[model samples]
Target chain A: MVFENKNSHWIDPYTHKFKESFKDINLLDKKKEYWRFASPSIWYDKFTLKKFQETRSSQSIKFDVTNYNFLRFNDGILDTETLRNFINKNKNVEICSFESIFLKKDHWSSLKFCQAQLNAEKSYERPLALFNGFNAKDGVFIKFKKGVKKDLHIIYEGNNKKNCCIRNLFDFEENSEIKVYEHFYGNSKYNVVSELFVADNSKFEHYKIINQDISETVIYHFFGNCKKNSKVKTVNFSFTDTPVRNEINLYLEGTNCDATVASMGFGKKESSICDNTVFISHQEESCKSRQIIKNALKSGAKAIFQGKIFVASKAQKTDGYQMSNGLILTDDCEFLVKPELEIYADDVVCSHGSISGTLNDDHLFYLRSRGIPLKEAQKKLIQAFFSEILDEVSDDNIVYYIQNQISEILTL
Target chain B: MFEIKDLHVNISEVEKKIINGINLKINPGEVHAIMGPNGSGKSTLSYTLSGKEGYEIEKGDIELDGESILDDEPDERAAKGIFLAFQYPIEIPGVGNLSFIRTALNSQRKFNGKDELNPAEFLKILREKADYLNVDMEMLKRPLNVGFSGGEKKRNEILQMALLEPRFCILDETDSGLDVDAMKQVSKGVNSLRSEDRSFLIITHYQRLLDYIKPDFVHIMAKGKIIKTGGPELALEVEDQGYTHLLN
Candidate 1:
């Protein structure tokens, strides 16, 4: 049975709308350009939406999330005790579950706040996004007041036979700044959709990590809107060999908006895949966007990167740049990259580049001639290849965490 | 001791002969110089000894310390105490110079069952040798051979040679692109490393380098064969009259 918010008044309307959008749509359409390298059949054939209940068991894998403001979704059910304790201790920003926030009818301002924020248009063109919009049972809603600063953490674990759909909406008012770190991993299949709204003069930084093992699959979709003088930066790391499909879209609706998207992917296991697709639209004047992606694929692994930038006719003085580099460790590994730009403005600058090659023979010989073994030499070069993107992360905590995680994957 | 016996090699792709029936021997503490014109197989012999790929060995063997090393990989040959200073050092981006040297040194030591040096100890040794070669400290921090001038590259090669301290060293055109003063500094660094248990094979096109490093035997090679062998005077003879006079 699909998840239903029976007791909550505010979210009941969206649930009905989600069910309406889910019917009469084909989820396995292969003709779509967005599904060129990835076939929806592979996902549909491998996973099912089975009803699962939380078992109250400890997490099999653990990461230190104590120091940061943390929340956990164990087997698709929110740990209410943990969430309540965290909320009581840190009341700087209003944080609560979507159910708790919408259950009461007398919270006039709260309902109005969420009604305005959560009612942002949901895209029906994508089947997975439509499914997630309707079936998502649990998620967190964060509301940041004007000129507020906050740090948030969200964790999603798909344990056992559970299939969970999560939806998150972040609303940042004018001059507010916020940073969020999201971690997704586990054995169950998960479909996640996030929508962010950055008001004028505000800033948002989103760092997401997908680190599932070979037995899991994650479908992630993100859509964001930036207003006048607002900025948005996204840094994603794909460390899982399991097939991960990532789609990101950002729209600059106001003047002087800026956006940056960067990602690092390492395909370490057999038949591992990381597919990333991004779209950025510039609708106003004096906006800028930058994209940098790098991938290192070992034997039997594949990586795909597709990115496009669109500049409207009135969006003059736009500056956009994109670069993608791939390193294939063996002949068996595969890398595919497609970077494009569409600009209608005459006074704009846009550039895109894609490069893929195996390790340089000269570089290998130089290392080996100095007495380094061949395997060690290749490892060192692979590490160097990834450092180009990893070094760009500005947050110390995230950088340290990512560095350790990357070392673990590469060394194995 | 290092010995080469009736060595014949050909370029792998074209199957053209480069080193034909070459024989030479060098005892410990002795320095031998091979002077040849271009296409005379001086660099080919050096590459063959260092086990570079694409050079097919058709006949004969090379022995170090009484055992043949012809079947070893390039890195294995390096671990067996063979060092080749290339005429043209390659530039490897994203690898620090000092870090590369340290890895090389420890790899060889590990093969020989010797304890590896920690970073502090490694830095101490590198600084001393680099200072002796007049190498700037900043150069060690840059990527290997990237943006290095000709003189700086040669000096860096010498610095590596000093740190490795191999049993057999081959300097293939080490003085090709250096000015007189830079040549002297390189020769001085090389001269300081001479000892009773180490051997040197210096290849050059002129006698100017031998004026400082003083080889015990000088061999003239032409058309893939060593034509003559004599004392230091043979180098002077080639420098004065050129290889055409020696050919006749």
Candidate 2:
């Protein structure tokens, strides 16, 4: 749904509706129904009907839930009597997290939907939309209870000899905040797409870091709604040979809403490129949105950044800013940055900017004459060029850790 | 301590000799100035002695203290106490001046099997030398000549020579672009570094610097060759009549 944000400083009007209506919103976000990052349902089924079926190749795994007619946890955690009560109390929720290690193909194929629970509502997200005509192939389902905040750390490792296609879905109840970290790394190469939904007053912060070796990945993401004062933040860092295209749309359906997306990409060698496209819509007045992407290109690599902001006619007083920059290290490298703004509201404050260029040549010459070799001289100049943004990263330990990783990455 | 016999430097694939040197000698406790007009190869002669590669040494045997150094690399020559205070001092950004000089000094020390000075010890000795030449303390904090002005850049060259304490420091036209005040300071720094065990090849086109760092002998260079040699009076003659008299 397009954001009807006006007067972006005001709290989201949708946040109030969810708290007031209080109906479990499984579709706060529309695109998420199409490109969910994961579907939790497959995980739930593993412990239920698929207990005998191993999700993976080896079955030396200790935890097998297939022997039980119903599977569940005790008191929201793994307690012995609580698990016994859950198994005896008519297993309602299917859980599949760490249990994936026991099964081949994942915790998914193990569980099958039993007709006995015909009255059961559908899970929150379904990632495998086209698998065997059973869209539940990859998905996550959460029966959100009011005021229950759950934290999840998810890592998507593309550990396949061949390419892989994955879809993910997630859900939240009213007044709940779900934070998910999606880290993507491949033993070789793969592509991943995800969809996300946010209910009223529910906050979702999805942090993604993708490293696809020297290949590429295509990413599609959408943020559904913020009923009053709900916020969402998305951060991405990509340094792979793969050219990745990320499309993010922030729909502010409520007042006093805020959304922020920041990303950094590194392009090197003859790799084609990394391009990011951001679409931010202010559907309500007083809704604020901000997006910034920085790309550093080296060798003959290329990078592109395209962002667009849309302010609805009804959405007045909206504030939005989009900035992008590309730093080229070699003459052969290239970059293109375009910031797009379509504001139907006249009173809104909106801004867009982009900058790209090669490293300063005179600076390199100066260092070399001082007896510093050419390559070492460049490393110093590059460090200086990126220092400004490096300081902005601000996490002292993380910054130092990343700097060491960057040195290792660029040693070639 | 220095000798160049039939030294010729050819650049590019072509056999055009930049330094068609016949011969010259620099003894200990002596400061010899090679004065020449533009393109007379004064800088080339000093560079060849310092051993910057790519300028192919076609035929020549340069000896320092009776040891042939023409077969050595720039670092080897530097180890043998040959320093070239460049006409254009290079700026090494990010590398602080104090550290750069110490690295160069310690590299020579490593080759010589001498003890290397720690940062604390090196700074102490460096500050004293800098104080003797009237160079500001701020200079040592900056990147090597990165943003230095013309005069400051030239003075930095001598600062390096003083800290390294080379035995044969060749000032490659170090006085070319300095102001009158800067010229005096450059000469003062050079004069402080001159000693009995060390020698100096003061390459210049004018005699203005000789007034401060008096040379033991003056040689007039023309077309890559030393066409004339005499005492300090020879500098006065060139200063009075220019290179026209020497050319004739």
Candidate 3:
């Protein structure tokens, strides 16, 4: 049964659209190219659309929000007191709930942007994202004024909920800059979608850290639109024990736009699966796009990466690069990669590569001969394998936190 | 005191014997040079001593200070004061050179139940030693042996030898790819570390390296065994007469 948001007059129309789309969408079709390696039945069979009762108190969730503008959510429910405090402190930026923004006459442009994003032509490709939109009764909407700079920390804590879905929208005006850190915690299955609009000459950096229990499953969709001379960069660090699929789609709509996406994941358990699907479309001239995805899988674990760069005929002088690598620790692990480049422009430079292999024996011997034990040496090499993607992250605090999480995952 | 007693070894993968009935000994403060023609198993002996995998010991024992070390791992042997400077240093693309050396030093220290040095202390020691070997700060900051010139890699190896301060050092054709200046610098670094309690095993094909770091005993090796043992004059004999006379 689809979730019905009868209370919100503005969101009911999208919920109805979701129900209509669900009739034709088949998530478990093995014939579908995108769904071939990852069968949705693994999670779809156990997913419950009915809202879960909040079984755990908010006091159980713990976080450190020092040196960050903070927001917290528990089982898809926001902490209004923290939101109020955040709003009182930051007066220049507009932060409000989706329903309130839709009702406000002065914020009609923001509402229109949200409606257009919901009705995007490519929305049908991702059925789970539409499901999230239908069930997400209330979500945060943030808009930055021109030339503003800030760092925001958003945390989601799940307490054994059967299913939790949330949506978020970010708007960066011209010449503005912002860095967002999204963290997911606890044992609830999650369906999340975030849309970003980057205006001319703006910079937006998004970092996501997913560390959750082995029994949970997470499906995330990220969409971005970049205008002239805009920059959009995102780094994802996933250290989860269960299945996780992160889908990212970025469109370069204006000239001189730059978009970069990088992800690092480690799958340790036999049931672990980490999937990343990314598409970058260059519709304008002189744009650049880069994607780097790396994963280290242990015995019986699996990793999948399907990335593509699409350049339109008029998008001349486009430079696109993509590289995907997997380090298989044992013979039983699997790494499936399909890196594609679709170029219609004659004057474009695009390249893609995929490689999967075990650790080099000579490198291992060198370290062991130097007095580093075998296990420590292997750990160091594994850390080094992910160092390239980690180097792309700009914040030191986040890097340290991610490194700690990676170490913990490795030990497990 | 390091001793190799009638050692016999083979390449484990192909089961081809490389070291056949070799015996050698080096007391405190003695520098031994093993010179031989190609395929003489000098490198095999060095690798066998360093506990590298794939070199199976079929017979004989390798003892350090009167204790057999056949069962120890490479790292365990390293903690017992054994160091081998490779002819071709492996390139690790992401591990920093300085950090690699520091980790090695600390690993040995931990194995020996000693306290490890902090970064500041390790850096101070490394800087002092690296300067002597002509290894600059930039080379140490880069990935270990990645994109380094032959001389720079050899110098980096010597710097590690200097930092680790092993009691029994094995130079496995360390001067093969080095120029005259680099050879001199490496020789000087090795000579500086020689003392009453330390020993050296220098494996080389040319006598030019021996001219820089003089050896106390020179052994001519051929066909997986040492054919003859003499003083430094034996190296000059091989350089002038070649190994045909020694083999016959």
TM-score of chain B of each: 0.98, 0.96, 0.98
Among the numbered candidates, top DockQ falls to: 3
Candidate 1 vs candidate 3: the lDDT winner is 3
Model 2, span A1-412: residue lDDT tens: 0113223311223223323333333323434532232222322232232221221222111212233222222211122343344335433333332222123343331232211011111212222121211121232333334455544434444333333333343444567665655445443223333444455677767656554342323343443445557778777766565456565656676776788877777776664456666777787888888887777787777776767788888778898988887778778877776677888888899998887776555445434323334465566655544444454443354345445545655665
TM-score of chain A of 2: 0.61
TM-score for each model: 0.85, 0.53, 0.93
CA shift at A135, candidate 3, in angstroms? 1.5
Q: Which structure is stronger by TM-score: 2 or 3?
A: 3
User: Model 1: per-residue lDDT, tens digit, B84-165?
Assistant: 8878888877677877899899999998899999999999998898887899989989988989998888898889889988
Residue pairs with backbone atoms closer than 3 Å in model 3 (clashes): none
Chain A structural similarity (TM-score) per candidate? 0.88, 0.61, 0.91
Give the 10-residue window scoring lowest on summed lDDT in candidate 3 chain B. B126-135
Docking class of 2: incorrect
DockQ of all models, two decimals each: 0.55, 0.10, 0.79
Candidate 1 docks at the CAPRI level of medium
